[model samples]
Target chain A: MKFKNFLYIIFLTTYYSFSQENNSSINGDFINNFQSYNDDPLIGAIAPEEKVLNNAYLNVIYTKNNFSIGLRYESYLNALMDFDSEFQGNGIPYRYITYTADGLEVTAGNYYEQFGSGLILRTYEDKGLGIDNAMDGIKLRLNPISGVYLKSFIGRSRTYFNYSEGIIRGVDMEMDINEMLRIENNGSYIFGSSIVSRFQEDNNPKFNLPQNVAAFSNRLNIMHSGFNYYIEYAYKFNDPVGSFSLESNNYAPGKALLSNLSYSKKGIGINIESHWIDHMEFRSERAKEKEFIINYIPTISKQHTYTLLALYPASTQMEGEFGVQADIFYKLKKGSLLGGKYGTKININFSKINAIKNGTSFLNDSLNIRSPFLSYDNDKLYFTDFNIEINKKLDKKTKINFIVSNQKYNKDILEGKTPGEYGTIQSTIGVVDISYKIKKGHTIRIESQALRSKPDPNATKKGDGHWVMLLSEYTISPNWFFSIQDMYNFGNYDQTQRLHYINATFGYIIGSNRFEIGYGKKRAGIFCVGGVCKEVPASNGLNINISSSF
Target chain B: MKRYLLFTILFFFLSQYIFSQEKLPNISVKNLNGKKVNIQDINNEGSPIVLNFWATWCKPCKLELNTIAEDYEDWQDETGVKIIAVSIDDSRSMSKVAPYINSVGWDYEIYLDPNRDLARSLGVSTVPHTFLLNEKKEIVWEHRGYIPGDEHKLLEKIESLVK
Candidate 1:
């Protein structure tokens, strides 16, 4: 055993020295988030018993000559206050080895992949959302011919540190007609198809569930000089799903259609997107909600960056919803009337979504709600937004951004309340952001925002009051930044109960390393990444995050 | 435990020596024209390249690129440096990238990493991540997170390469 150990050590040394002369290399990144909770009565923030919670992740990869291996180590010391308790452990849950050749590649262990806009399958990671559903099996990617691509994978979806009970398999293929058919063209025309399936044993006592369910998707993409068009349609067979309520059953077929058309140029752009999803909630394990998501529904709503504008962010309804969004962008000339000294840019966006019109399923009336294609339940509007933004630069060192928007959010649907329980929250929001450079290496920015909410006489929601936000940030070139923000629910119907949520943060960055610390009162609400959301209890805390990449 | 420490330190140094001039991984990203292009093919007539990792929803990323846009033409004329913006927008906002870039009237080349495959390969955890490459396409310098006036440092790096 001693001789074997010596030989191993010798081999490692030789390998290390040889790597220095070869193309072998290593790269990794690290991130740690630590927070200390404290009780607060104002915002109803509560301290967890653990007092301090932490989450850390590290990724290491080594590569050499068409071969690579990677592993991700995650530690959640009782998990953070916002994360699910199931992730309260440490493990190397993600590890993979991949080999690449001229036209083929293979990966084993864990991998993230997607197919055709991810309407059918998209396995990825979002640390903030506590989601990492990489498949733990094998994947194959092949480029058989010019402009032809094929991919297939068989695996089990990861849930925290463990794999789900269901087995997932999928295959995707794409062909570029211009290249495969040898057609002469200045644009690209591609056609793709995908099939994703899941298998799990059915032990439900109330209903007979499908042991295997498959979904198929077809898409087409066309791109010209300044115009692009893409469309995808997906269909899934009737499968009885047992939700978190293990005994309940919903046998429904799923269908989804999404399309986007856009045209753009140097100074002008316009786009329109529409999608309708019906009974399309899919998971590797049918009982899991957002935990083992085997597919991703594109959230068509605009992603806002302003502090107040993001409070009532739109959520995608996976069961049945139809939505459409249109965006228009135009830039006025530098010297034009509306453009001012420097050019001004105008952006207009409008989006509307409604519950799909449905009736008893003709095929299975007792189990499913059937809806016609593109059918909209006009009375059940889920969400709607109309916003416009104008950005202009007054001089070389001064710039301003102004936005005004009106939105109607169905609180009942978005917050998972009973239908019509809280009705709709309609509000008008306005924001102004200004930035000025005082010196070559110094800058300051100020943002002010207001949201006017129409009160609900018969509802019970905490934050529907009129809100105003003020923020100021000072950045010292290349190194440090400090910001303070206050969100005040000033015009609450219950005037005595109004609250101000103030937070302050400081950060420093040197090279590829960054460190940030903050003290704040967090709001209690549904925290979402992309369209997936989870409720996070309110917490008063001091938060620190440090990250480094090499 | 001491032996393990030795092994770790040795391997760390070995990696640095080997990857001091590491090239981008071989991954495919979609150009603004919605066509697949290999990472090695994105360049400007053998000039130094700047591969910026950004996202459509990231405000700082937009700020960084917008700040650089003001002097892009002059920088190109002086150092022949080309800026290539890689947006890691998922399917949720992939379709908006082209319009967003065009409305800003930026002349830089744009690529889309819908699945963030390229971003992951490059060890980019945050948006507004910038990488500078020499004529040989080897990553020479990288900076994470963008602060106002940081573009000057980037310009300095490019100037040194051409000088």
Candidate 2:
């Protein structure tokens, strides 16, 4: 860890020098344009109870014509999140220089890369999520010919505060069949394939794990007339581990398979996806903890958007599961009664997932010390949601939209807690959203939603009941806006526990700078961005903001 | 007719090039107080807008915003710029927006894109996915991650546009 920190600092210093030279044009304007604020003594010590320690970073990118190089300097005040204490000192987390010429791209030091669907091969980094699986090795991308592409890389996966001990390597090639085969005149069809393998020496005595593991996948996409279709299938080999079995003598690696199919045209679309896994647990380091898994298992459930509808979200169980999902979307064209003046869109989706049932039946005479693994059951342990939306032009100056949703969710598994030992719990939710344009530059939106669940043995006195919410926003054109919202817990669980959250805000826009102020009472909830979520602590206070570019 | 065809082809290519400029998708988000504002609606009105995703709990995010607050007025006057600061703060710190902004003295337009539905749709994986959109509502450029001094470069971009 000490060596890693030393190397990181050197990299940052070098990058800083490089950026100073390359970014000379912009640097001059920056220093001349903005004023710096004096450091506030309280800024560092007045840490909020719920907030992570403060960290700061500076990054500069200099691009001249087609060549660009960038560097980032980061300092973690006290080693935030899972960062090792060894790396507490301020330094550069990553600094890389790259150049692109024609269709070939090359990068040295650090970079992020991903292959089709990221199934088998992906080396992306997300600093906010504490995920940096970037390969610290050479990467080569070559479009040798007009229709064919090739990429290869050899490196080590980024480990906490350092690179992994194991060497990682992979190669990828994709051919645009339509262009490569010169069939563009007869419509277009594209086919591609990829294989990724990893090798790591194992010295642990508990099991004799295979050092070399490989996974492969194939993809196809076709477009003709007004319709388009895409499909991909992937499979991984077995690799046993301590987590899989307690019996030291009979352990074997696991296998997995996944596939997706979709078609779309004009105003109609359809999608179907399926996944099955025997024991495929892919991770950057097998010895690492479970939460540090680099790869992911796709869930078949639909991701909800509305506040109440998203109260319960399903997390993919990586161990063992088989599932399928289907979605359909259609729209009534403009001028039709259902479509109104603009158009009416209808969306329907459903998904189900359950453990794969093993075929072994219990024997009456057997005194087996080890129970057979549970097999998939006909019993449904999943969730489903349906919604419809109507969009219409009320008049020359006004437009309106309405949406309705109904959802059913599996509670026990999603929430990771249940009231009963073996029984499953289900929840139902509904929501309504409406937006109206009262006049030019003026609009208002309202949303009301609720959720109800069956009383569970573990439920707190509140029998499965209901919740209600009201939100309204009024925007006045060009310079000013205001909004108010309230979430009221009207459910049966505990009436007195029912809490109401309210907020009101105002904003002003001047030139390129926008200023806003607000006051409100908040609640605790998981805030998600692109499937990545963060825990936000509840607070009650005033807020102000100012921002501008250039 | 041939001339018309040529004109049509040129128009098609031009429009395609103009629209495919890597701009983030237009999304409606609520202000800190809960009013809905579409990102494109602001950018479409001939104002270059900076859309920054941030969180109250994120220390770096606070620093980045604070840094901007100190220089925002000059940036706006020189470049006809607007900053649409979108807070990803969840319910826990949702009410802290007004006081927080007031204390920081930032004069940027502040809105709360809570739940991050809009952020998800736009592939915003982290805070500080600062996007620079032109007057035509096209995303001209974007940078992921931020550090101190990076705002200076952002200002340079704005200056280039204004000039």
Candidate 3:
């Protein structure tokens, strides 16, 4: 009730003050996801007590000349499966007002921000992953000089309907070397530095902890011709916090280093990246989890699109990790022997991650898990992947894509499973997709995927057996689309465990409105977008989705 | 609380009556070469412009762009239109964008909005969102999702505008 009253006050003030502006515009978007569930014995899916679950969002933005006001209304009623139950009822969780003029901009209420590669600070929203960490506060951006940019913010990170206990404050500056020095060469250089600090009350009874924790990052970028090199190093002060996964209280200062080099031309591109991280997770509320995260360590692995290949996607560890990833993309010219009538595009990627060695043996309790730079434990491998993908146009009317992937996932280490419970999974995946345009305004696409796993006596349910999936989609001009897919665990030795997940869907799109409905069985697995991940439970259900913007 | 909610609903509807043409804001986005380019400074040479917000990992977005590529040259010749592809890929995937677009032979101008600042300002929460601008560079039409053969509808919209 208090929040409502506050908003009412802000709304009236803005409306009455801005009513005189004639060049005003209002825009918004709405999305709703509804699901109805059924009990599935084989997949271990039980219907929720409510039987139906839904999540909906509506965002409205009003803008006129140099001022804007926006708000987002969200309703979960009963949250969907795999969604945080804390998102209970409905409220306006995001609202902001902004004004900009003459190279100076100010935003108050709520905003998202990021600094150089997001190593020390990044706040964003990924609706698909149900992660929105927008900060509610005041932000100022200024470009007083041509080659210099400055930003500063002080706020509290959002956690559902509430805000984190800690207060976050950050400042960043970026300077362009060429513009600052008046150099005339085409080459480019930009240097940036950021400092982020969080303040929370120290309430622990057992140990003394710092009430204010600060982190700093320095970054540089060089771009000349087709080559680009970038790096950022971040260091965090001593912060004693809880690690939920390890079930331990940690007292350590954290640090991270990330670098990337890439070269791109008309027909080819190559990139190499490396990261060394240690206990660098910064959250607005130290004891809280994903909801209060204040920073993001950039992920380097290739995010696969195929179902089987994506099953073992890589993610960041909150404690310590070191990894390297590389990718190469090339295009075979048209009329060549391999390209045939059209050009062929090929991409190859490799990534590996390992745990960093802890320096606890030599350090005191206050800095217990601090490790030296770039040294990783040889035995604690986390994940590794190598994949190749090829896309080609067979003719004017048809296109095909092929992907082959190999991965080794350490389930025991990643999931924090104790000894004898699970083991590593060594698997290979292959996918083929073909899209054909029957004629103008009509198209059909078919995809097939296969995954084979090496047999191991200690394998767990996740490492069970081989799987195959097939999908077909048909579309009719500008408005309608239909698709069907089925995935089967064909290699399961136990007949009762061999289940087929089948689904079908159709969608209609008109201008800015989209409507989709589907009924299907969904297998339990980890769903990830970018580097963020979440576990989804198996279910059988009917889903309806609608979105519109105006 | 109910009264406040009711007031907001009424205000929202009342503001709907105040609609007017709005142009792109004066926000900065980086190009492939890492130089900042203000959104308001892009010049289309009096031709219609189409800005498509996309990401590297979105399948529908890729499909939409590829399908449009097949007729891009002809469409430009007919209506003098060009697409400016704005990528909303975050820090992790931003580098992959330049290579991906080049390897796929897309000639569209590519800009990076790593923090999604441009997208948020434009009220674009979904990928494959497309905006069509008139010769005056004012957004005249918008589309949220892409379906097969959507390019033809886009072309029709462009032709009517240019006519």
Quality class of the docking in candidate 2, CAPRI style: incorrect
> Where's the lowest-lDDT run of ten residues in candidate 3 chain A?
A359-368
Any runs in candidate 3 off by more than 4 Å, and if so which?
A1-21, A242-249, A359-369, A455-462
Could you tell me which residue pairs clash in candidate 1? Answer: none
> Fraction of native contacts in model 3?
0.61
DockQ of each: 0.55, 0.03, 0.62
DockQ-superior candidate, 1 or 3: 3
Clash count, predicted structure 3:
0
- Which model is ahead, 2 or 3, in terms of DockQ? 3
Better of 1 and 2 by lDDT: 1
RMSD of 3: 2.6
Candidate of highest TM-score: 3
Writing each residue's lDDT as its tens digit, candidate 3 over B1-163 gives 7677667756765766756665787678999877889987787799999999999888779878987886899999999998999999998888889878877779999999998888987878889899998877888889987766788889999999889
Off by over 4 Å in 2: A1-59, A73-91, A125-132, A159-163, A242-256, A359-376, A396-399, A418-425, A455-465, A476-482, A503-550, B1-163
Where model 1 places Cα greater than 4 Å from the true spot, the runs are A1-21, A204-206, A242-249, A359-369, A457-463, B1-14, B17-19
lDDT of 1 by residue, A1-550 (tens): 2343244345445655676455566777889999999999777788989899999988776666677766676889979988889897766688787888987999988899999999989998888888888999999999999989999999999988889899999999999888888787778899999999999998876677889999999999999888999999999887776554554456668899999999998888999999998877778887666677778998778888886787787888877789999999888988888888778988899999898887323234355446888888888888899999888888989989999999888888888897557778888999999999999979999999999988445566644578999999999988999999998888877776588889999999987899999999887877776767778888888999999887
